[model samples]
Target: MFNLYFISQSTCSILLLLNFALKNVACNPVVRTKSGCLKGSIDRNIDGGKFYQFMGIPYAEPPVGDLRFKAPKPKHPWKGIRNATEEGSACPHRREKRFNQSVPLVGDEDCLFLNVYTAELPRNSATMKLKPVLVYIHGGGYVFGNGGRAKYGPKNLMTEDIVLVTLNYRLGILGYLSFSDPTLEIPGNAGLKDQRLALRWVQDNIRRFGGDPNRVTIDGESAGGSSVHFHVISPSCRGLFHGAIIQSGSTLNSWPWGKLDGAISVVNKIGVKAKTQKEALDVLKSLSAYELVRVLEQMGITECSNDWQDISPVIEYPHEGAFLTKSPIDILNAGEQNQVPLILGYNSKEGHWMNYQQMAAKAMGTWVAPFSWECIIPWQTGIKKGTAKSKRFADTLERTYQTETPEENVVNAWSDSIYDVGIEQAIKFHLKTHLAPIYAYRISVITRLNYLKRSLNLWDKPGVFHSDELGYLFSQSITPKVSPGSPEDIYRRRIVKLWTNFVKYKNPTPDDELNVLWQPVESVDPIKQLDIGENLTFVDTPEARRFVVWNELLEESPFIIN
Candidate 1:
């Protein structure tokens, strides 16, 4: 009897393996990208359907050595088969601290790679019915993030029947910092240029991977959202993609506008003197990529610093087929953008993270005291400019940060001035300019079991913090604390349905079978917030009180125009 049972179990196991293999086509090969023929795989998941996967396809030539700061050019065609089975290396490191331990890994300079995933499994000689493509740009405030970051893997979206693409762009000094020395002509925003090149690559060759070239939807969170905002009006990016989804980011946020001057300042601080423009460019091109990264990292301003006026894409004259608007607001006002369907919104607890950090610093008694009492060199340096603007900003902050105490007030003020005001300005401007259908929402899920399980939180602070909503869309990049299984999981399913429907039909509202008809966002009406709490409801006007406060502040301040 034992022998018979063993034989029967072996037979059953073989049959099961056969069934699984038949149901899923793993790593199928295709011949249609700019980089020659490549292979991909397919699999099924609990939430999504069959998914076709392509990993580490070269989107641009490796930006290494002298090519480091220049806008990425097209990758040269290869002769032999290129291995794309594994994810390509990530760009140089930026800090990501969790629970007081550093997470370090190997990264490379030649990291301009992308991954593609699709729901359709195209058989030989059988055409795949074109599906809407949703290209996601990951957020790390434009300084530190990788498309390879596990939390943002495209598996879930692929199963939802949307073609998904994620690519790595230049970051930190390599991507953003410009050497002002007259010798350097390549100047600023190599990173932003890298993103443009990737989109161009997609426009040129996504159809072969079962994606509709014409139905591409670009989306991002945080800095990624900022990039989407930049691309909207870029002349070089015209007709490259259709539709955009901006989350938790907007135009009114502090951006690095003066590319050439900003680059000069950064390079000068790093001890590079430019006698002439060409000499400056030659010196910059000579520095090793790793040496530059190491030097910038030691400056203490490397990671966790998004200098409002020193670290972003700037308006540049069109050259080599690359062009971008001066600012997002300018594009909206002119209506010169792609004018594709858009879904723009932000989280309800957007500013809580920064507010909490300030509070924590105060509790530890390590808070750097205000500058009014001190003007010594300890707080002032030639590289750092302390102007009337800084003084005014400090005085205003000191006044508005009022809470139970001085410490409490500082935290409140930071949150209000930064995240709150910034997001409000962009949304209001978008509403004022364009007439296309727009959908907006406020994410308000705090401490749900399922969501927390799949996120990366720094301090256990509650509420949907920045990029916290990302996990609801993919299984990658899960926080160690959040466990699976809860009512919170349902939110992800609902969101994927909404987003895919939007990409497919240019509307976030679902059909009869999907059972939800999300109304379009209105300028006067209160937001139909997606409260991810237990037994969620559509509030008449979510955060009505806060909106009034922000709007009132905007009217008083010259910076924000309602």
Candidate 2:
């Protein structure tokens, strides 16, 4: 009898071990997409709220070989359940350098992937209410960055009832190389096309992941922010998203908007004797993806240069699949844009990042060059360099922002020239025919979560640097962990709430549970904005005097306003 009881106990233990192993192997959630079934994983937010993550889902086919420099093709359907627990490779781009060190290239050419995060998964689609979607496009000056969770994690955002998505698009030469000849089939703005395709993918498949397609809000920072504005103006992107949140970027930003002689420059740099556009195209296509990106690095192209020439978005010649065919200013002036609810703004000191290296050099007592007035001249004014108009504008800028030091002058001057003027201009043009409310803001809150500023050793410096507000919205890996009920945590929570509220209700202060009645810009004469600082104060005509000078200067310039 004792032997029989021992044998029964052993048998039960073996069965229990086998059951545990099976559960571990097959417990992941699987969602059926139009392309195929995607197996995602579950994660818990900082607040211990459970959320579902679907990572590295291919939205477009690999733009390789013949598909290079062309619009992304839709990803073909796949068989069986695809493992989406891991992130796909980022698009081909050089790794961000630190301390002026040369970084190796990272990512793959076949990197058209996107990640989706949702707080809840629908058990029964017929009875479940879908959540609002927030599609984020990352910014790297149209050259670097990815939609990976390491940089743009959904930990804080997942605590709210929303579906978050981040996507990877083509970058640099591979994405924006355009030939003058339309017949060459290389119209620029392929990167923008990649983004548009991802949005379409969201519309068609987001519902399956418990997302509401009709209530999608597109958000981006820097180049990605400008991308959001581009979509807002593009006729093809109408109805894809209901609202836009543009942070530190705009279509009117002179740096990344206009076409440059990129194709000719590439041909000359690569030593290709291409006499015709087709020959240049052939030579470009023959080069490997790594070779193409290596060339861009060799060109010494860093983000936020005073020089406007770069491989960025351009007005493409009219073609069947051209992403942008006209100037964004013209499009806005004609009221041909998608007129969605917009929340556009910049940091209190947008130029801090641009002047960081110089500031550091000064602090270290290193040899720093004298400030050049030419750098501060607004490139959008179209005044020729060294011309009488250019000198007059530069002189005016020097007098206007009369700071104690040249570095301070640079910070203020670049802030207006590079970021503020363009964004304000976009708002002005958008308001001319805007039927929807425009919520403008200036992020001035400073906290421990200011990762970008801290990383550059500028945390102790005055003024909130560009992209400081991003730390409050999304939990990045570099940022220190926020303690519950801490000041940083409270600020982060408030920012997230405001953004998510805009995503849901199109009004940031839907009910003002946060006790801040954020108002929208009612007129361009004196643009009102929410100053997100220690206190959410409503400021009217904050930049009126500054912009008046800009307006007068632009009016005197030769560039005709449509």
Candidate 3:
């Protein structure tokens, strides 16, 4: 239990560099960042170890008004010790009015902030020992999500003696929409630049919070995983972090930068149109963020899932001041970026959730149509009756996945269809090009205490979802919390040890504690996969049941050209 003490809000005064000292500290944790001094609260009831949490600290100035659709600027220095103990607003996003119905987009535009959780502060940068750092990015298809969710609380992970950081960035049209213009007015990848600025803040200020800048690890799930993948290849972000953990995502996921010209033509049909590209840019800038996001949502739902390509990171021309200079495949093949230890993998039953989604959409058939959730194809649209293109796609899909239930087959086929072309291909390419350790995993565990199932009227169902690993490591920070004897408690420790081990040292397997020796895939071995489930096992990466058929069809058909 913490010995309770309080730092008066009225008494905080600016301290000069010449007179700065830790002697005047109260029970709360106070550290001076490059931009300003921050005061945070101490937790008394954390099971493993009580820690300090500095919440909603501004890393960048609000990206509103003239700064919209541009790279972030560092927060200007404050005059007094700023309080950083509350959560900040999340980026703007669109929500479905109903299960397949069009809805108005909603969120705030001034949502660029980061949070930090640590055990203690260093008096001086030179003499103090520091711990490894972990920065997490949340995923919602680069369209919807926030970093400060309650489930992402770092109270449990900090027990392993590492610093935890999470951040928010621009989303939807404000973040990823780009056009082919003579002037690079809407320089894409502003969201990624927001992330890069947050990393820079950590590098410059984390030392004061007892984190080593040289030992930082960037970790993310889903689209956030893809963001980390882009950072690995980004030239502007060299040396920003030392390691990466990408779960259930890759650069090839959803948006793989083929041709945006087709997408730009689509953009012109519905949105505020003007005669010239410059006029279009001016018209777009004139619209409010909410209006812009609503228009993008409408457009996204109208197109087929595969061709909804306008809402992701882009391959900018050289010296264009964008995040990715070339495409992800181009960069990975050329080997022209930072090299770091990486832990990447996908969950078992990733497509099970997609199947459920399809079923739900059908059951609620009365709900409005054209409800497009990014990254998920509709249950009925793959087999449209019109063109040869549709027939080829449908025929190949039918051949690839055949089962008792045709609907379920389509659902199960999603895993390989999505990953085989995305994560799986990226990993195979990475092994050939990079010599750094590559530890791939497949998480197949189904939790007994799945809260979503019970709360959402889905009972007795068992499946490991795309983001199910998150609950074991990051519990909902609330009452009736996970108990010490529960499976969640046990797995939390095991998972944290594996991840922090990779951060502290360049290996996931520990030297002292008992752990499965997760061996890295070598040049000779095409597959050495770690399976984390009810029991941990290392097995040959089994070829997906649908791989052969899918591969043959993709090679033969002209529908799905790379």
Candidate 4:
């Protein structure tokens, strides 16, 4: 009453402070990671509840300049809050077939990023339980996949009491090039190292996002699935994840490991001195990231080898950072790896996805695309295309698995070689070595929306092509232009329920939701394989006959199948 103006100023100051306090309260979901404080946006669930969404969070420093082709370094800590709202750039890769070759491509070199999705929290609730975590590594044959794609939204997945995490690592040349030097200089599998670092990041900071670090599960499909297999054996990933879900990719697959010469040849074609590794390294270091990728593209050789290999993970040279010094099959056969719960399985028609016409073209001496099978080694092994040795291998393939037609034979060869046989070997080895709960399933569900039905010829009358389960799993993996709640949608829900139940509870069979029981893989049980479809039908291992031929070949050969 004595000083009205002073009273008004004091009131304004109080209002200002109240506004600031409210702002801080509104940002209650902010997470304090080891790197820095992150301010993520919130999204409304289908149930009209809000959940924290942290996107484009840097897990490792950008693999640029000196960091390129080297193991990933942890990201430095920041002083202030980082806005993690947008998705990160995908690692550099060759865009699939295009009409215009002249146009500049997409992707970036600074792509070591991860995203986290936490379930909706109640207002001012401290009793909320930490959720189980699933960190997924995207697969594109170690060449062309990004974790931030629109199709992989965590909306449906997050509905369960699970924290979903997805991440990107280096790909193709920047990821898989092996200098093959003993000094650990350019030790191959940098991409895999990137994945390791991302896992470390999750282990370090997932708790801040209300995730139980101890209950982390690593999962992937195709190349991503192989990555999961590698983690199972990698010492660096020992305590990072508890359970692994390998879908449609066996590390023992004919793919994944790049031939030593093939990686060198890729570097040589980039206008580098082919005389020595040092010279090649010098030239590679001097070129810009985009320039290097462009040169690789113009050369018309996909990655290091053909699509089957294409410069993926390789046994690292014996050194400090060596993740794998010998073949994974040898180590697993000897029972040397981190013992953990595992769910290993493959799609119904994992091999029918590859084009028979394209393979026939390459075998018939036509260069259809950059990654044709011509550059392959063991099928020829620098012995020239028409040599007797090459012919013998091809002839052996025909005799190994007799099919209706040559085209069918080619598709079947790819199917068995790339996925079925390899998976069988891994399963057989797992049975021999580890006694932990190892469950294997044959995903024989015939979906209404078969991805490969229209794309590739169905000479084999395959029930489901590779990655058809992805549509039922991830909302965005495939789009059939059909609305949800179809037969496929119901199956998708069933698949998700089973998968998430495994994550929440170790055994997928014990869940009370469905009366189905997915038993652990066994030698005596003929109907151990879980056939996931409209109804749960227990069937014998579907790929038994194919494995018989493959087991014999794998046992005799010292070198891995090429």
Candidate maximizing TM-score: 2
TM-score of candidate 3 against the unseen true structure: 0.85
The stretch of ten residues in a row with the least summed lDDT in candidate 2 is 1-10
Off by over 4 Å in 1: 1-28, 98-105, 124-127, 179-183, 255-259, 270-283, 301-309, 355-416, 447-460, 477-485, 512-516, 524-544, 560-562
Flag regions of model 2 displaced more than 4 Å. 1-26, 98-101, 258-261, 269-274, 302-306, 357-371, 540-544, 558-562
lDDT tens digits, residues 1-562, model 4? 2422233433433533443456435553455577776657777543345567889999999898778888989999765556677898888865432112554566889999999988743222245577888998887777676887464667667667888899998887788777776653787889999999999898888877778788899999888998999999777678889899998887766567775434557666555556776766666677776666665554553221224443667776678767777767577777887688899877666655555435544564544553223333232123344566545645555675565566555555566656765676677777778758888877877765554453343534755667667665654644555546777666766787888887888777676567877788777223256777668767655366656654554445433532
Best candidate, lDDT: 2
Q: Candidate 4, which segments miss by more than 4 Å at Cα?
A: 1-28, 44-49, 96-104, 121-128, 182-184, 260-263, 270-272, 298-310, 356-396, 399-406, 448-462, 477-485, 524-528, 540-542, 558-562
- The C-alpha lDDT values of all candidates are 0.60, 0.80, 0.67, 0.68
Over the stretch 53-127, how does candidate 1's per-residue lDDT look in tens digits? Answer: 678888888887557677888888754345556788888764442111134534688989988887653442145
Count of residue pairs whose backbone atoms collide, per candidate: 23, 0, 0, 2
lDDT of 2 by residue, 294-329 (tens): 766555532232355647788887878777877777
lDDT accuracy of residue 471 in candidate 3: 65
- Ranking of all candidate structures by their lDDT, best first: 2, 4, 3, 1
Each model's RMSD to truth, in Å?
A: 8.0, 6.6, 5.1, 6.5
Q: Can you give the TM-score per candidate against the true fold?
A: 0.79, 0.91, 0.85, 0.83
Model 4 lDDT at residue 115: 93
Candidate 1, residue 293: lDDT: 58
Model 1: residue 41 alpha-carbon error in angstroms: 2.8
User: Model 3: per-residue lDDT, tens digit, 1-562?
Assistant: 5211133323344332322464344455666777877778776324756678888888999998778877788999775577777878888775422234454455688899889988766657788889999999987677777787465778667777888899998886677656666364565777888999999999998997889999999999877888898898888899999999988787766543333323354357565456665665566677788776665555533223354355667765554456776656567777775789889888755665555555565665532133222223321123234457555655666655566365455445566555434566567668768768888888766554333343344545445665777765564533236677677666666777788899889798867473578888774334567888766687554334444454454445312212
